[model samples]
Target: MAAKTDDSGPVLPPAIEYAWGLRDRPPKGPRPGMSVPAIVDAAVGVADADGLAAVSMSRVAKELGAATMALYRYVGSKDELLALMVDAGYGPSPGPPPPGTDWRAGLTRWAWAEHDVLRQRFWLLHVPITGPPITPQQLGWMEDGLRCLDGTALTEGEKMSTLLLLTGYVRNEATLASQIAEGSRATGAKPSEMMPAYGRLLAQLIDPARFPALQRVLAAGVLSQDDDPDDEFTFGLDRILDGVDALIGRRAAT
Candidate 1:
């Protein structure tokens, strides 16, 4: 589908146009086994099996048994393909919270849905964020997130900012979790073992006098072992929502 663009319309990349169904597919007889969605699916598969690093255009093309140049015919470039791959990888949003749900509960659900998606496809955390969400699926997620704040006293900008803040928190938490898990795999250390090992190492290196606060934490065995990932996730999510709750309360009062 060709994009609805006029003489003064904003220029979008070819892959993005295809994603929006705004760009036509190959005109040369449908290209028999090649399409934007096919190409993106292939790339996502490559990332899933290997990793984001394994998802080169040539690799995706090889998987499809098509020439590397053939991929370019559908997706303008590797960056374009990566963008499309991320859009497809997200699949779709969990959708807005059920009707009549409180805003906090809706946002809580939205945040968890995103957390679940990233955890399942941790490779997505590795993709560089060159810009904000604009692709179809990405925008859909954004819409759902924003919808959670609808009918609140907050203004549009505040709503957008709240989503941004919440999404950022979710991504940061997911990224850290992914890194720790990767570290465990690389070192052959189980999740439960790594934190305790680190605590021991810190206990040896840190002087109680020089690092009293850290020493107190160490003494309390706070890092005795890894915390349940879900527990950690819930704690952070609740705190962020608490701040949002306060903001909403203030807005409503005024």
Candidate 2:
């Protein structure tokens, strides 16, 4: 894998550099027992049990029963560790879209699969986007997403941009879903219970005269209703796909 770089070229962060095969494993550091994978896995374990905030080097070392310096043998910093953990969480791509699928169909599957991974590992949603996909699994996912646009009239740049757009949509949707899930867990209240309370708050706060569009939304009862997250996701995905199809059509026409 190609390493991440910049013109000024600060020392490459060890964890991501290792994943990109640009840096050596363990880097001649002490504690041969400490491996990058082990450190990342331990960090992930810490994050999983306590959340990303708890996944510091000290905490991860505590979880691994090693001194904090031992982890320094593997990961360069907590940010790199987080990058490794997030990419590890992805594991790998789910393989290419089904055979004979059109670009729309293929990209649709690609988007949904990406969405499902984020949903399953909701922690991935919380991982701050610091850089492009450099780790193996994330690169594979990027390739797979680009493959969905194979043979399309869209240029390579357009395919990459389309991926950025779709990825943003998936991440935003996953963030909302993850927040709802966390809220449910924290309050011990299902979304079905919580949304009504939420709607009522809006109802009390917004007068029809002051917020007619929002008031209309309240009157329609969609807010109070038990909305399926998947339905909302599908609606958004379809709209995006429609826009992409229009672009494809126009490109083909030209």
Candidate 3:
């Protein structure tokens, strides 16, 4: 048999090719001794322990016991490393919602799953969104969200808009929660203490005569920490879903 030969052209960027397992390997010699997985894991650890601000090439290199320059052979830059960390942290998507489940239930589960990821890796919220996500794991989450509305009587554009709305709501909620938690940590104040203090400050700042609705809300004790965070998330989600249901019903009636 003749020596085997394969001929295929390069198909992806060097970094992405390496990510997809298509990059060239060093000739049979001393191994490079570093792997992409190790680098990403170190970066994730840094972010988890000290927040995204602590993640840097030198820090990750130090974590891996490798020279800072050596990391560049595997990851092109800190941006590449951040991208890898994002994809690695995403891991895998949740299983599809039970068959025939209503869109609301399916979507609520989807949103909660996303919330769990954001909460666990709270640093991700600080990762400036460079652009629409292109990584496999991120796209998989998008697909999962779309799948939730698979049976709905919606056009493709409508499906996208609905998903975007839900995603925005979830992201905003998570961001707010993270801010509140950070504030609590910084000020050493419990939510119970903070809410009332904030309410008092607002009450002091706003004239009751000029803001009747705000005064009513303040008097109703809505600023108290009586409601669990889960209850608040469910309430907002239910209201959004109800609005969608009304729109769908009106469309069907027409």
Scored by TM-score, the top model is 1
Highest lDDT model number: 1
Please list the C-alpha lDDT of all candidates, in the order they appear: 0.86, 0.83, 0.78
- After superposition, which runs of candidate 2 have C-alpha atoms over 4 Å from their true positions? 1-17, 20-32, 202-206
- Tens digits of per-residue lDDT for model 3, 23-131: 6752121226687777889999999999999999999989988889888877777876777788777667776778888888988898889888887888888887666
Clashes of 2: 0
**Candidate 1: tens digits of C-alpha lDDT, residues 1-254:** 12345699967777786667885653132358788788888999999999899999889988888888888777777878878888888988999889899999999999999999999899999888877667998999999999999899999999999999999999999999899889989999898898889999999999999999999999898988788889999999999999999999999999
Error in Å for residue 210 of model 3: 3.1
* Model 2 lDDT tens row, 1-254: 23456887645666666777887555555665668888888877777777777778899888778899878767767777787898888888977777898888888888888888888778877788876667788989999889999888998999899999999999999998889888899999987788788899999899799899999989999788777889999999999999999998898899
Please estimate how well model 1 matches the true structure, expressed as its whole-model Cα lDDT.
Answer: 0.86
The alpha-carbon lDDT assigned to residue 8 of candidate 2 equals 72
Question: Each model's number of backbone clashes?
Answer: 4, 0, 0
Clash pairs (backbone) in predicted model 1: 1-22, 1-23, 2-22, 3-22
Q: How much does each candidate deviate from the true structure in C-alpha RMSD?
A: 2.7, 2.9, 6.1
**Where does the lowest 10-residue lDDT sum fall in candidate 2?**
24-33
In candidate 1 the C-alpha lDDT for residue 202 amounts to 97
